[model samples]
Target chain A: IAGITQAPTSQILAAGRRMTLRCTQDMRHNAMYWYRQDLGLGLRLIHYSNTAGTTGKGEVPDGYSVSRANTDDFPLTLASAVPSQTSVYFCASSRGTGELFFGEGSRLTVL
Target chain B: GESVGLHLPTLSVQEGDNSIINCAYSNSASDYFIWYKQESGKGPQFIIDIRSNMDKRQGQRVTVLLNKTVKHLSLQIAATQPGDSAVYFCAERATDSWGKFQFGAGTQVVVTP
Candidate 1:
């Protein structure tokens, strides 16, 4: 069903560069989220959107931003990526509550 | 300030044996709890979930137990197989929140054949 699709499965970027991780969901869910996963740290919310044109900051929202202009797409942008930003990024969506459907993930490495 | 955490960082189990993973949450207001399984390079996949009103929930070969008094949660897998080897995380959602979830560090399960 292609529940969620993420672009650029893996990437390596130089420090201080800008990057954007793209996500799309065909499930027509009302809520979407961006989370980063690091070794031993688990998943930390970066940003989230309850619906189109609405956004909110999460636990670790610094240095990253997200926009939900429409229900089908939500993108996460790293304005000035740092080495510490090297981690796997995941995009998720849910109808309103309960379980979340996550994308395969985008692995980014900042050198 | 409220967060979810796991009791163990890693666990090893023999195939066909039952495996248990534990989790604890600090927020008493959390009403929904879920367990997710993540493979080597994939994102976390939903396994099972339990709500505050219920003490236990079962799915396929997996069972989730919740203890609100102690703020404890557990996932039990019966007849564990090699395919069950993965990182498991516990997530909690506050009663007032719509979709915001707080996740634990996660426990890695290794099943030996």
Candidate 2:
């Protein structure tokens, strides 16, 4: 089963450019999340959606925005990417508030 | 923002030995905690989890302990193997939104054969 998949396994973007990381889950879960992982730091939640059509800001959502248009897809967009936005991004989905199934990750490098 | 900090950045242990990793969270409203193992270039994988109502919970060779009183959490691995070498992360869920999970810095484990 394709639990969770993220598009653009890796990307290089110029600073100030806008980019969207695509995420899809085959599990049909209600809760979806976006997180960024940096060296020497754990994954930090960017945004989360408890259900379709609802999104909420997470710990680090200043430069990121997420939309849950449907149950299987939750996309995270980075507006005006900066050097500090360079990190590995992961998308995860879970049923209700239960355990999460995560994607391999999309590595973004901002120059 | 509340911090979920780990006690150690790296841990080295011999194969077959038991290993313990510790974490401390600053949020008092965290109701759920989870341990995740991440290998290089991979997303974190759930190892075990413990709720605030329970002090300890065990899985195959892994165990998670939660101390709500101290806002501390720990993961214990028995019979550590070389395959267990990876970074371990501890995460706590906000009571307000269960899907909002905050993670700690993480501890890298090196199991020497």
Candidate 3:
């Protein structure tokens, strides 16, 4: 069903470089979210979009940004990535209610 | 408004034994809860869910219990197997929010032979 698709399954980037993690959902969900999972820590929300044309900041939204131009795509951008940004990034979508569907995840390594 | 465990914990169990995973939530307004299982190199998959009104729910060989008074939630797996080895997470949804969920650090389960 390809519930959710993420690009660049894994990546390695140098500090100060820019990177964007792409997320797409075929479920036509109204809401999408970006989260980073760190070792020994839980998944922290980075950014979220309630619907197309609207976005909201989450707990850990400092080094990242997201855009929702349509119902199917939400991309997270890291402008000048830092070493601390090294973690696994996950994309999720929901009907704007409760349950969520997640992507396989994108592992990012910043050196 | 959202809080999760600061560190991940591991639980080990012998095959065929029952496994219990626990989680705690702080927000009293949170009325919906869910459990997810994540395997190596994979996304978190839904296991079971429970709302505030109910104290317990059961699925195929799995059970979820909710205790609103204590703000604690638990997942019980019967007949643990090697395939059950994974990281389990608990997420709670606050009332009237835009489907926002707060996730716990997660508990890693290791099933031994």
In terms of lDDT, which candidate is strongest? 1
Decreasing lDDT order of the candidates: 1, 3, 2
Q: Using Cα atoms with residue i matched to residue i, what is each candidate's TM-score against the true structure?
A: 0.95, 0.92, 0.95
Model 2: C-alpha RMSD to truth? Answer: 4.2
In candidate 2, clashing pairs total 0
At residue A17, candidate 1 shows an lDDT of 96
Poorest 10 consecutive residues by lDDT, candidate 3 chain A:
A35-44
Q: For candidate 1, what is the DockQ?
A: 0.58
Q: What is the C-alpha RMSD of each candidate to the true structure, in Å?
A: 4.5, 4.2, 4.3
- lDDT for each residue of candidate 3 in B46-113, tens digit (9 for 90 to 100): 99999999999999999999999999999999999999999999999888765788999899999999
**Poorly placed runs, candidate 2 (over 4 Å):** B1-8
User: Fnat of candidate 3, please?
Assistant: 0.66
> Which of the two, 2 or 3, has more DockQ?
2
Candidate 1, which segments miss by more than 4 Å at Cα?
Answer: B1-8
Better of 1 and 2 by lDDT: 1
Residue-wise C-alpha lDDT for candidate 2, range B1-113, written one tens digit per residue: 99885354889999999999999999998998889999989888989988888999999999888888889999999999999999998988877867778889899999998
- Between candidates 1 and 2, name the one with more favorable TM-score: 1
Off by over 4 Å in 3: B1-7
